[model samples]
Target: MSYFGDIYKGIKTLLTGMSVTGKYFITARKGAITQQYPDNRETLKMFERFRGEVVMPHDENNEHRCTGCQKCEIACPNGSIEIIWDRQIDEETGKKKKMIDQHIYHLGMCTMCGLCIEACPTDAILWAQNYENSVYDRSQLTKVLNQSGSKLKAGVED
Candidate 1:
């Protein structure tokens, strides 16, 4: 009957699969193709296309290029941007100006989509190539970028 033929075929298929696995099990000791990860961290390389975390550079003048335009904040679908604005007297005009008070980044919620970089008018933010972002504490993943206590210069903002 066809049923009996199917049973014999199944048994033969099982044996064929077992033979392949047995060969690997016996040959595993010969040499490993796997590259040990942490042991060779110095030589570890990532693709140039990989997108990483965003970073902002603060200058000595305590001025960030971010013009409070909120283009990036608006473009983000998840609303992850938390920009704290503070009023400061513009040194040139001696008038109160709205500036970026603090820029907080929550890495846990970021998708690394690179949308924020394209949305930036001044190109103040960029994706750094360093990708080892693992950490034990979730709170530590949150980064504050304005620690330099400096203002951005004219015509250059990210």
Candidate 2:
């Protein structure tokens, strides 16, 4: 091709790109591609399957299904889960039983890989819908999953 032909081709390509941009600019009155995050916070919705963070759900009696199996702790790649357990004498059975003293989860250390939830045999841990995991202090990120003054429910298999 001639030098002029090459120049014409370049200009034609540039015009095609400009035309697409111009089309969008002209149609901007219809709607926007960008979301107004802060303004739309009240109506903003997340997907049902969105895995935000790990949480232990307790019943009205404050009883949880965690059996202190430590499966979640073992599955966590980032060492986010720590299950502190001890042998306690069951009042009914009068036999020593392995019970969880505390279930510590470090939100900051968690990569949200969902391995811990999947490994939970008792369905004690699940992905909560709450997406806001930010905290001002690092210490606040480490949370004890068991509620205060709560104990293992009766009849929970040892």
Cα RMSD (angstroms) for every candidate in the order listed? 5.8, 4.3
lDDT of 2 by residue, 2-23 (tens): 8999999999999999999999
Compared with the true structure, what per-residue lDDT tens digits does model 1 show for residues 57-144?
6666666677766777777677666778778898877998878777777777888888888999897777777779999999988887
Give lDDT: candidate 1, residue 148.
50
Per-residue error (Å), model 1, residue 98: 1.5
What alpha-carbon RMSD in Å does predicted model 1 have with respect to the real structure?
5.8
Best by TM-score: 2
Candidate 2 vs. true structure, TM-score: 0.74
Please list all clashing residue pairs in model 2, or write none if there are none: none
Prediction-by-prediction clash tally: 10, 0
Off by over 4 Å in 1: 1-36, 59-63
Candidate 2, RMSD to the unseen true structure: 4.3
